[model samples]
Target: MTVALATSLGDDALILGQRLAEWCGHAPTLEVDLALANIGLDLLGQAQFFLGAAGAAEGQGRDADTLAYRRREDEFRNCLLVEQPNGDFARTIARQFLFSTWQALLFPDLAQSAAPAIAAIAQKAAKEVAYHARFAAEWVVRLGDGTSESHRRMADGLAWCWRFTDELFMDDTAKFRPEWDSHINATLTQAGLATPKPVRGITGGRHGRHTEHLGHILSALQYLQRVYPDATW
Candidate 1:
């Protein structure tokens, strides 16, 4: 259970980091691009810690790099939300807003975990996730209350991501759900956006049944590692 939990956590950060990295040189503004890139780097750093912990828990030869690059799509345990395409600026912001908000709740709880190493990692990462959540939230409010087009796009983006929000709590601790609800509802209210009606969310990402997007991400992400095993800088 420990190994599986750690792996799922690591995969979430790794895959989302990759998704955020795709915004580099393509964000609506230079500041936004730099911000997103930095956020991506933060997520990658978290991934390293979590994946390393997973390897240690497994008592296997695998390390962070080995687990991250060697795993096939079906072997990964990231949530389907992180694997989704960053469709537009609005969508990217929406995804980050949702994921980082969850991360903010998640890391703090994990900081109290019995595992000392995981607790330490969670303590450090909780700070970073705080900034990520705030950054995305500000954008969500800004875009949502902006001009007509921005408002429409922001609403559309939230609609796309709304379904996945439920799965964040699926098969996990029930403690975070209440806090998550209050935080999300408050943010959406301030943003002048109503919570979209919940739909039946697509699941199975945690169980390694991912959408086709994970394969495309892994192909690019693992290319060099796959080609030259053990080669390093």
Candidate 2:
């Protein structure tokens, strides 16, 4: 269970980090670019810890670097949402809001896992997740209530991404390993944010199904690794 959770969480961080890294110089403002880059770095750090823990638990010869750089897209277990393109600033914030909320909820539960190493990594990552969620939530409020254009864009972003959001809360591991539903609700309630009703259309990412964008993302991320199998920079 710890290994599975760690691998899933690591995939989440890795994919999202890659997406946010795309915004480093392309964001609307220098401050926003720096903010996104900072968050991307935080996710990358979380990915390193979680992937390292997963590798250790699996007793595989592969380490975090190999898992991150060498894996094919179908082997990646990140949700469809994170792999989606950052359409606009509003879209990026929308993605961040949804993902960070889920991660904040996830890491706390993971911190109590039976595996000591996994728990330790989660404990460390929980801090970063907390800040990620807060930053995204603040941006959500700012954009949601800021201006007519901002509100329209934010709402459109949320609508475009809403379908994929359900995948984040799907529970298949018989024991309800993380109780993600309750955590999501609690976080949204605390933030005074409400998602659309019913919450249907939950999808399964565990089956290795992914959005069309995953292939492109994997292509870019794996280029250096494939070209120089043993090269280090």
CA lDDT of each prediction against the hidden true structure:
0.91, 0.79
Best-fitting candidate, scored by lDDT: 1
In candidate 1, which residue pairs clash?
none
Model 2 superposed RMSD (Cα): 3.0
lDDT of 1: 0.91
What lDDT tens digits, residue by residue, belong to model 2 across residues 1-233? Answer: 76677778888889899999999999889998999999999989989988988888889787899889887777787788888899999889988987887777666776775478877887887898888888887877777767788877877777777878767766743234245445545544553455546545545565578878888988898888899897886
Stretches off by above 4 angstroms in model 2 are 172-194, 197-202
Candidate 1 lDDT, tens digit per residue, 110-222?
Answer: 89873787888889999999999999999999999898899899999989988877779986656788898888789889989988887898889988998889999999999
State how far residue 184 of model 2 sits from its true place (Å).
Answer: 7.4
Clashes (N, CA, C under 3 Å) per candidate: 0, 0
What overall lDDT, based on C-alpha atoms, would model 2 receive against the true structure? 0.79
Superposed by TM-score, candidate 1 places the C-alpha of residue 67 at a distance from the truth, in angstroms, of 0.3
